[model samples]
Target: MAAIVGSTPTFVPPHVVPPARAIKGLALIAGFLRNPLEIVPQDAYEQDYVAFNGLGPRFAWVTGPDLLKTVLLDESDKFSKSVQIEFFGPLLGQGILTSEGADWRWQRQVAAPMFRRQDLLSFVPVFVSATHRLLDRWRRSPAGTPQRIEADMTEVTFDIICATLLPSSDATVGLALEASADRLQRSAMWRQLYVTAHMPKWVPQPGARRIRAAVRALRASVGALLTERRRALSQPDDLIRRLMAAHDPVTGASMNDEQLIDNLLTFYLAGHETTSKALTWTLYLLACSPQWTVALTEEIAEVTGGKPVSSDHIDKLVLTQQVIKECMRLYPPVPTTSRQAIGDVRLGEHLIKAGTSIAIPIYAMHRHQKRWRHPNAFDPTRFSPMNEGDISRYQYMPFGAGPRICIGMAFAMIEITSILATILQQAKLALADVHAPLPVARITLHPKGGMPLRVWVP
Candidate 1:
């Protein structure tokens, strides 16, 4: 048994132990062919943490509540967000999502005021209206036919984010923004997989070109919006205006055009992708778990009573939130997080050197046997407030933990629940296929073949 820090003994599995070189070699090869990342199962009873390569000298994985606490809470400063995320820097500029250190803190402070609870309350109607539009669009589609639901969800979320975050509503710009987002995601995934294979970032691969083109298009669109917003003296109650008006309180310097564009793009990309994936997965789970779906339907009906799902109403639908939580647990959109060690550190008995790339595999952690009871089962009850006490804090971080946790956590939760409730109010959905598609690890965890479902008027 390997001696690990903390109260309990930490044992490396047989696959990770003897013949370490062989395992590393296998991972390297897989990187060239597919994604270098592998989702591993953690222990069933004690603690669940999955370890994988963090694309640098360090070997990284997620496990045990104590470990999560150390990474997210206790020793957060020891780590920094991976430089690899800078692949998005060109697209997102120095936006909060792609920045670090002082820059991140400054932008976070500026953006924080715009996302206050009161402001979010005002945006509830935007969410409800967008969802209603989506439901209406679905109703017009041919019935009993397999609908590529993922695409629809993507469009719906994109529109909501655009309406709520941007200054203008020109259909042309909206369409371009949506197209750019799609292209950027596809390109980023290609780049991530290629870089893991040890390919250079500047390689003129087809995927690389696509990514560049996507970024260019997105930049042009955002640039136009920024120009318009700046030229017009009067501003609206939206994220764009807030960002434009934001200034570093201490330095009193405002963000440049480039910074504004990047942050705006970041919000659209990060905000939409995660929310859409969560909603899609929630629908899939609801399809497979009819009992839960029916119960959820009853809850939605009783709570809203045919009213649209406002943010206030979203809170009342506890079961809907649980369903979303469970889906996120199983298929967290951002399945892995990485950080580079700023200095040498001790993780238990393991002496990790500075510059090591640490990986926190949320996917593996969610399914680890030691951390979860019946790890493979889809039981929303596990997340119930009453039942959640048994779970470790670090063991179940779907939105991540600590200071570096996702900034848009509350926004995403409200968006997902609101949209899902709106859909339930208008339609009943079923999976078009008998079996769910296998999960694929992209930049985000997505269904390989896309989520196809049959929608019928309720």
Candidate 2:
């Protein structure tokens, strides 16, 4: 897609990480532990592909769709999950996200039906009602007071996930996970550093005790929910219920308590966190770009006729969808991901040897200067249907691309559309602080120091 030909953008949303030259030794460790973005080079944004040999294996980072398709899809088995176990294994165990071969496939198959279009459409009310609950609080309180958008989004999305997936569970479940959320997120940075350096998870690191405590607390919560489900008089129709009934099509195996906790925690943490971060950035972009906000509000008005966001209006809110698409482009939920080659593979002209690590720094790729015109500007029009086809799927992957892409992509988009439509219908948000929050990688992309917005029903 071509750049919007006009005068310079007045507000090019915050992109604080200046492209870094290669950093090394203690500085590299410090930089990586602080934020994974530091390890990425400018070439990642300017070139289709780049490789560096270090950090336990020959490292290849690719931004082009062709090369990405080769690695993420065509040669997927040859390129297995890298370091995911070290980073999230403590929290998720041998869940779908970290498992390989038959284990990952069957687990994915079992959970797949829950995310189908029909099932996801049924979830729109939960999405709308949750947003309304948060908005109702703003309606009751003082007008100009700042609301922590990040925290608000997190809580609302967390509510949505639990309500939709674990419909039978209640306040106790929320209390269990809520207590551990902050500590767990903080621990991720250290985990990433440890995994990248090839250090075992048990290696003494910062926040190690709290991280263990957080993991234990989350697991206990899920375990209780599992027991609660088993003792129920009838099987309620929800994800938990589905998991109980599901058996592996191939192996005929079923999930035990430990496995249930593993998958539940995976969905809980991955599901809520990514969508929350996406909305947080979307609102921030809206606050900075009033024109886009006006555009979205108009679309929401025209489509819903000032009614609450319903499933019918989701597809009709095009501009609302575009703004979210662009926001994700600027600040992708999972900033980067990697895989290791199990066998020799050739991507483009480069021959990847066995054990080579392939990194896909999605944040850089989304804003890659060569791939996107006026790459850093906060313009949503590029995602418009007419222009969107001009872009390649791999070059602009916010939900990721190919087979292992997020299972909840449709769920996220529908939820995002519903929540954005509901909130924009009544609430007006403005940046409370002049300081722009830097987008940082912490399992999911989060605005550093949180996003505080002056939200009011005006």
Predicted model with the maximum TM-score: 2
lDDT of 2 by residue, 1-458 (tens): 11232335556777746445556677777767777877787878888878875455577778888999988888787888857766788889889888888888888988998899877988898999999899988888799789989989998999999888876445888777877877798876776776776776467888788898999999998888888878889887777877877787886878888888899888988898899999999999999877777777887888889888888988887778878998999999989988888899888998889888888899999988888888988877788787889888788888777788999999999999899899999999998979689888887887888899998885
- Residue 248 in candidate 2, Cα distance off native in Å: 1.9
Output the TM-score of candidate 2: 0.96
- Lowest summed lDDT window (length 10), candidate 1: 11-20
lDDT of each: 0.71, 0.83
lDDT of 1 by residue, 274-363 (tens): 888888888887877667777888888888877877657867888778778878887788877766667987666556678766667676
What TM-score would every model get versus the actual structure? 0.88, 0.96
Root-mean-square deviation of Cα positions for candidate 1 versus the true structure, in angstroms: 6.7
lDDT of 2: 0.83
**Colliding pairs, model 2:** none
